[model samples]
Target: MSAQSPIVDLPCALIGFNDLVALLHALFIKHGTSPEVAAILAHNCASAERDGAHSHGIFRIPGYLSTLASGWVNGHAVPRVTDVASGFLRVDACNGFAQPALEAARALLVDKARSAGIALLAIHNSHHFAALWPDVEPFAEEGLVALSVVNSMTCVVPHGADRPLFGTNPIAFAAPRADGPPIVFDLATSAIAHGDVQIAARNGERLPPGMGVDSLGQPTQDPRAVLEGGALLPFGGHKGSALSMMVELLAAALTGGNFSFEFNWADHPGARTPWTGQLLIVIDPSKTAGQSFAERSQELVRQMHAAGLRRLPGDRRHRTRAKSLEAGIEIDAKALQQLRELAGE
Candidate 1:
């Protein structure tokens, strides 16, 4: 990893979205990002947060910058698609980080779906993508239904066993809604996300019950133990495990990448390398509903909202984003300090 500069303590202040993006772009460039690619990455990171995906937001800068420094990912490589066909697309990331490839693929698929009414895209040779929701929500905003799956470095243990046999294997779905943000459902198939465990460990906090098992395959709340040798449990028990397997098969197997538990996990050379894969499906609702799709979706959303179901999946995120935009990025003081230090500021 490249050495970061020192940390600087600063208070949060109001900053325009574009200003924040410029700062990120400058930071990435200072860390060796090509000027053009840095802007794209900064845009993607900011867009993720705008859609309420904090986990994949600016916090990911360190990881991405480090990956670039280690030569594990190509910061300048442009992803290319192969086996392109109507309603189907396949992309090769060329050993680059997943975001740029995913963004390009998503745009291509959205256009393809608009023309063909539906499209499926598979991607391989990508690195760990921070959040799954950002990849699918755009389709929903465009009045299409979207589903996506991604396989990660193995951190999940199948039920009745231990030793980390599968990746968290996240899946996300989105559909247009009549009001507010699109209806989005994004979650790790594991009992909890890897980030959650990392966050817990950073804060020296214990995980809630049934989240993970220790190296000995015994359930434990100690986040550090879980991070060390333990594995995360599947959410919803067997059901979640089944979903994880399905995602691995669909995302990895179909894309001709390493399977779950078979992927490289090490960040350094000679260690297990990360070989992530993803699958995306987009459906144009108007094709099926004959142009009334949007109206019907709005009605359904109205009904759901009237039922007193507060806080739809992505609602809080949208709200938080609006607040953040109104009051700067609200970055953690410590995180900013660390970033500045990394940049040698």
Candidate 2:
């Protein structure tokens, strides 16, 4: 999710990546997560902040804490992996966070991909509250092409529909290139992400037109209305809706997980994360590509630049990552203080 509230001129403080991770780890542990789970989640969240994805960064700490407190998600559940086939892997997250489950099965998944030329991992009974890019980018870093999708809670209205029936399902892809960082992109099928809506609400900002509708199915610009009893519109109408449906099929139905509408967290107060499923496909390009896969990818990028493309999908993030590495991640001072408080520092 992108940052909805601008903090560029806010009173800020710079913190090293490691320091931020330590703080987040302490905070998660304090909120009832096991040490191992805390470590994985901490690194994931901190990486978002480091890459300028503020909506899924420390901005999500409160939701994580509340969900933990409600006991809606297991803070210590271990994932059980099943090698369904030579190129297929399945994981039952035991009602835990999806990232940990992915971490648990990542090595086996990679091994299968290398050996079989392609591999698929289906993770179910899990909650995924953070950005999806982080889940697939590492595979690209390891020289594997990766694509992932996850369905969130039901908040988006399918095209030509009167009510919401689909989540802001996101698709993320990452591929290695010889000349630069991995080519990566993560995008919500909805006009906007649910997290961005929440951020807009909290920051007293109004959404742009066509983002969502109120309880009465009337167009609305107020973020609170959208969060309280409204529904988001799918991006590009039918095109995005079709992709969202595909995500539901891949991430939920195929994974033996709940569909967006099948999820009922009403009984679990403060449970904000969507307890759905995730699907990941990894490919060993070397197995099929006639030429060097990374070199081919770089060539494509060069052609795009030649065609006057100023920025690629992950340009801002890579630039931000480099800057953060050199100068530390600049965060709002108040937000940093809140993180410290959460960590009981």
* Off by more than 4 A, model 2: 1-10
Worst 10 residues of 1 by lDDT: 1-10
Model 2 earns a TM-score of 0.96
Alpha carbon deviation, residue 45, candidate 1 (Å): 2.5
Q: Give the lDDT of residue 143 in candidate 2.
A: 93
Cα lDDT for residue 302, candidate 2:
99
Identify the runs in model 1 with alpha carbons over 4 angstroms from their true place: 1-14, 48-52, 265-273
Per-prediction TM-score to the true structure, in the order listed: 0.89, 0.96
- What is candidate 2's lDDT per residue for 41-126, written digit by digit as tens? 99999999999998899888888988998989999999999999999999999999999999999999999999999999999999
**lDDT tens digits by residue: candidate 1, 1-345:** 121332334555444577667777878888766676677777778776555565577656767766677776766768898647989998888876666777667777888898899899888887755778877887888889999998887789877664677898999999987656788888999999887786677567899999998889888999889988888999999999999989999989988666766754465553223577888899988788354776787788777789998767778888877887777666656665555566566
- How accurate locally, in lDDT, is each candidate? 0.77, 0.93
* Root-mean-square deviation (CA) per prediction: 3.1, 2.4
